[model samples]
Target chain A: MTLVTVDDVRGAATRIASDVIRTPLLPCARLSDELGLRVLIKPESLQNTGSFKVRGALNTLLTWKENGTLPEGVVGFSAGNHAAAVAFAGQRLGVKAIIAMPHDAVESKVINVRRYGGEIVPTDDLLGTTEELASRYGYPPLLPFNLPEVIAGQGTVGLEIAEDAPEAAAVIVPVGGGGLISGIGAAVTALAPSMRVIGVEPEISNALSLAMTHGEVRELPRAERTIADGLAAPRAGNHTLENALAYVDEMAVVSENAIGEAWADLADSAKLIVEPAAAVGLAALRTGAVSLPAGCTVVLVVSGGNADLVKLAQARMG
Target chain B: MTLVTVDDVRGAATRIASDVIRTPLLPCARLSDELGLRVLIKPESLQNTGSFKVRGALNTLLTWKENGTLPEGVVGFSAGNHAAAVAFAGQRLGVKAIIAMPHDAVESKVINVRRYGGEIVPTDDLLGTTEELASRYGYPPLLPFNLPEVIAGQGTVGLEIAEDAPEAAAVIVPVGGGGLISGIGAAVTALAPSMRVIGVEPEISNALSLAMTHGEVRELPRAERTIADGLAAPRAGNHTLENALAYVDEMAVVSENAIGEAWADLADSAKLIVEPAAAVGLAALRTGAVSLPAGCTVVLVVSGGNADLVKLAQARMG
Candidate 1:
């Protein structure tokens, strides 16, 4: 099997350079001063489609376009960002796009998906069950979580960290179906083996952690709650599981309230509107669930900022 | 007084290169597709202090330190960002800082100021009345509005813009005390005189607009009521006014609701948490307050992201 490597990430960086926004690596003096660790943030929140999902989605779409697999149209089922990503990528490639989103998806996300020229189909199926909609779209689904090219594309983030802060001891990534962590885990291990790669998950939806413990893919009960809808994966992907088992060092879980609190802290204190999944790394660090090595340079990959507006308002009100 | 030029910005870029984050310039394809104009954003929201205030503050404090102004310490009065900036600047310069904020200042800003080693002096003096507190602090007050060096320091933004997007047809900036606009205006005009320099102000605290029409600084009574507290300058500083008058091509005012909506749009669409002041530029463009030349490139300088968490929550909720 041809697997993703550092060279693929470098190629992705080159291919996506003009299209993707190389979101900055910011020094978190406030977080650092508080944690006594050198903290830096790779803010994927500023990426196109308001999330890092765009990186993998765009990369996959572009690769398909290059490989002639991009047919008359493309489709996807996503909570928000991934749908937006497919729409954006399709729009960029001048291909038709149909995005199936849960009926309960945020109004803002719905608007953005439409804004990017995607045909939005509302699903009556319960929230968090997206695979069925993907299969029904009449086109190959754009899987943000499970593809090799997508994972290789997302791994460019780790490539950036290694280039920018070589001394970083650990890179913490928020995991969902484990796409982000799997990509980053492999990249960091290959490029900077001394750097530890930790995956953070919302406790209610710690599918990756469960998989790690079980040493196999475990399907958790549905209806798990998390403010980080992006990270609320019900099960781990086989590809992502293999990557995690091979390269990822550890998995840590943070609570629902903790996720909300971290989200609020990111917005209020850090001046970022990160989704709950993106905040997990900070949540893990803040809550002392992970005792970082002393004086270690730590990098937290803030996954995305396309949070539900109403939920954000609710979180703020609470 | 010695003023900062594009050369100074180049020098600052090198000096702060090792310290400050090189913020990304994002092309808004969605906005670009909607409008005939090509829109680019300098996301200073990702700055070290989560605001562009750090640029000027860093330059000024460092200049003072190099010139031997480290005798006692530094002082400032602000509702949010400037306080943190001064504190950050002082800390970097290895000096003591006393930041006086109003009683109603946002909690996150207060915490950030404190976290940056600033000694906060809470004052009952209502918004726009910080002189007394500054006098009490003994340390010379670093007024956000009045300082020439601050404006000159902020001029560095324009330098970056000219270097990064030299073909830009217009540069829009959020205006508060006019320091940012003043500096940015000067740099933009000097670097690319053909580019239209525009200033955006919250309708509530449009001191510079009133000053422009009247040919003198005029304090507006309603400046205290806006959600964009950062841009709520009661009076325009003479130095800032001079620069704005000389360099700015147009000034537009955005409503409070527009600011809130812009904030929400940024969070939802752009995945950034820009404060009301920073949102003003986008608000003006979104609301069609700022007319663009057809097919021209427009650059919006998002000045900061140090939003008040509680206020953000309220905005999100309401």
Candidate 2:
């Protein structure tokens, strides 16, 4: 398996520069005081489509257009943010997008995909339905995370962090299908080799953590449902796993309760509204699942903010 | 009243440059599309102390230090943000801060004040209690919005906006005691005279709106308590009113429901977590209380993000 390179990540950054926000690196003063480590928040939650998925989606679609292979339409499968991003990119480029979402995908995410004008098909078999649609309708498939192009796209986050928070000793990212952290791992490990890259997942959705332990990607039995819905990918992308093996330094898993507590704390103290999946890195750090030394500056990538208000309210109630 | 000038704002910007985040101006793709106008977001909610009050607080104390008149301690009355900011500024500058906060101030905000090392005195009469403390202890009063230094500091936001979103035709700011808008009015009006300055207040805390109608600073009987706790000031400072009359182009009052709706929409679409006071600017625009021409570019200042999660949950349940 060919791992993605920093140059490819740089290219994606140039390609998608105009489309995505150079989301800020905010100083987490409260957390810094509490943890005795300087914590900087790299909030990709503020990115276009409210997630880092926009970077990859835009990069892939923009690459296709650049190659003059832009299809009339595309079909993709995602739990949420990626599908919405694909839809948004399709709309931006005047291409049709049909997305297959999990039958039980969060309502806000489904709404987000539809808001971008992506035709949504609910299915229990997310990948199978998307594949069938692509084959039947003659639309090109934009597989979410498995592609090198997507990996390269997401690596831009690392490039930005390297530029914006160079003082950071480590970069922690949320891992779902490992698309985000894979790209971040590839970029950061190549460019800032001294800075360790850590991936965080909910204990229930610890695919990347388990893969790191076993030295290979294995499809595990579906884990119990997690509040961190975005990290529930039971298996990592094949390309992502390869990239992870090459670049990622460590992985950690935090409990559902920790994730929930982190989510609320982030909003209350940090004034950051982030989705449950995006809160896992903070959860890991705050819960002692991934402890760093005092004075160690860490950059926590808040990967998305497409949070459901209802879920946010429920968290408050608890 | 001696109104603040753009140069004063510039000096404040330089003075507090290292102490605060130069918060980014975010592109609101969804809001821009829905409004058929370019809507950029200036999220001071991401500022130090999670509000723009830090700029004013930092500037006020910094100026005192620069002039060799730095006091032994400072007394201030605020709903929350300003008090917390004063506490933060005092901690940074090695001065004591005693804050008079409303008994009904949001719990999170109260926590913020305490966290910043400010000694809090809960009071029904915020200003009177603060004044009494200042007189008794010889701790100079750091009034929230009336001071030229504080207004000048907040005006730095306008300086950044003028530089960052030069295309904007209008700037919508949330008004409490008019300190923020007064400062912004001073900067934007001086730096970009063609741009209209609009102030938005909740109907329950329409001090500036009523002041504009009356052409003077007038204390209205206490209105109904607003969900926008930060914008619940019943009167504007005399200096702030004078600046508003001179530099502010218009004032609008929005219903509490509109503020709540706008807060949720900001979280949902723009992925911005803002307090209800901050949401009123968007609420005014969304509710047609401050309508702009189609294709007009407008900048909305999300003034702070010290939101109560319980309130957020309640908004979601609605």
Q: Quick one: best TM-score, which candidate? A: 2
Categorize the docking of model 1: medium
Q: What overall lDDT goes with each candidate model?
A: 0.78, 0.87
With a 3 Å backbone cut-off (N, CA, C), the pairs that clash in candidate 2 are none
**For candidate 1, lDDT tens digit of each residue in B1-318?**
344455665555554555566666778765676677888988887777777787777777766767877536777788888888888888887877787788888676777788788988788663434566546656676777677677766777787887789899999998888888777776777788888999999887898988888888887874256888787777897777776778789999988888998875655556667777777887898898998878899998988877755556567666
Task: Give the alpha carbon lDDT tens digit for every residue of B1-318 in model 2.
Answer: 577888999999999999888988888888888888888899898888889999999999999999999999999998899999999999999999999998889987998899889999999998789889999999999988889999999999999999887778999999998999999998898778889999998888788767777888788786689888898887887889888888999988999899898887776667766788888878887889999999998999999988877667568667
DockQ each candidate and list the results: 0.51, 0.65
TM-score of each: 0.88, 0.95
lDDT of 1: 0.78
RMSD (CA, Å), candidate 1 to true, equals 3.5
DockQ of candidate model 2: 0.65
lDDT of 2 by residue, A1-318 (tens): 788999999999999998888877888778888888998998887787878998999899999999999999999988899999999999999999999999899888898898999999999998789889999899988977888999999999999998887768999999978888889988888778889999888887777767767778878677578888877787876788888888988888889999998887776656777888888878888888898989999999988887877677578667
